[model samples]
Target: MRQLLAPALLVAGLLLSGCAGFQPLYAQPGVTRDLGAIEVTAPAGRTGYLMRQHLDDAFAKNHSVAPRYTMDLALAEARYPRGVRIDNVATRYEYVLTVTYVLKDLPSGAVARRGRVRVELTYDSADQPYASISAQQDAQDRATDEAARRIELELAAWLGTTAKVAAK
Candidate 1:
């Protein structure tokens, strides 16, 4: 049984290896460099600041360098009460963050790409006031991080494919 299992596993691995069209985005030649060349505009308010910080880290943008592309972002947030108690209290809440972004080519001022991302998170509301506030803050942080990650991935994939096409 063991001998047969080993051969079967080997065959499966070999078959899967033959499939194409799967490549790491960052491993592509110019993707990382392109991401680093972008400048993200500073956003407004506390939540916006968190989102912008995450994006800056993801893009690896250097403070000293002039950006080749400028990215402008707009953020909106909403909260909804859920799992309501009988006494007109809510036990849980849902937080939603929506971010829209535009990427522009610096030299020509042409809009290169535009997209939006939405993230949702849920958290329990504690009995204590401070605890409830803390929980809500944590949810916001999680949602902001997720939104930033999605935006980074979208931008990287766009840069990878567009760079390849432009090079051709």
Candidate 2:
């Protein structure tokens, strides 16, 4: 029984291994290397600073290597009063951040990818000056974090696909 079970298991394993060519997107070779080689350029401001920081961390970029791609970013922001009090003052506010990015291949000077990512967050508007500012700042931080995450995902997927195509 043991000898038969060993042979059956070996056969099943071999068949399964040969049956599919499925591979995870991130598992592809050169994806991480390409991501780390991207250079990020964002506008100057608090929101832009936040976005750049988040993206750098997400990419785990290595500065020592020469960049293969340059990413240019355009950012737009808006704020609106959501819940209004009876006195016509905003009790809650919604902050919106929209970011458009263009990735250029440095060597070829051609566009590799174009994409946009948006994030929205809400915060309470406190009567106290410092408290209100703090709330708004918190919202901005959260929104940038989310936008950076989305951009990272899109770029990674694109890089993986590009690598696969090049490989073939």
Candidate 1 per-residue C-alpha lDDT over 1-168 given as tens digits, one digit per residue, 9 for 90 to 100: 998999999999999888777777787777888788888885788888888888888888777767889889898899999999999899999999999999999889899999999999899999999999999889988988998899999989888888778778
Q: Write the per-residue lDDT of candidate 2 for residues 69-129, one digit (tens) a residue.
A: 9999999999999899999999999999999999999989799899999888899999999
Q: In lDDT terms, how accurate is model 1?
A: 0.88
Worst 10 residues of 2 by lDDT: 17-26
User: Model 2 reaches what TM-score against the true structure?
Assistant: 0.86
RMSD versus native structure for model 2 = 5.0
TM-scores of the models, in the given order? 0.89, 0.86
Q: How far out, in Å, is residue 26 in model 2?
A: 1.8
In model 1, the Cα lDDT at residue 104 comes to 94
How many clashing pairs in candidate 2?
0
Q: Where is the poorest 10-residue window by lDDT in model 1?
A: 19-28
Cα lDDT, model 2, residue 19? 68
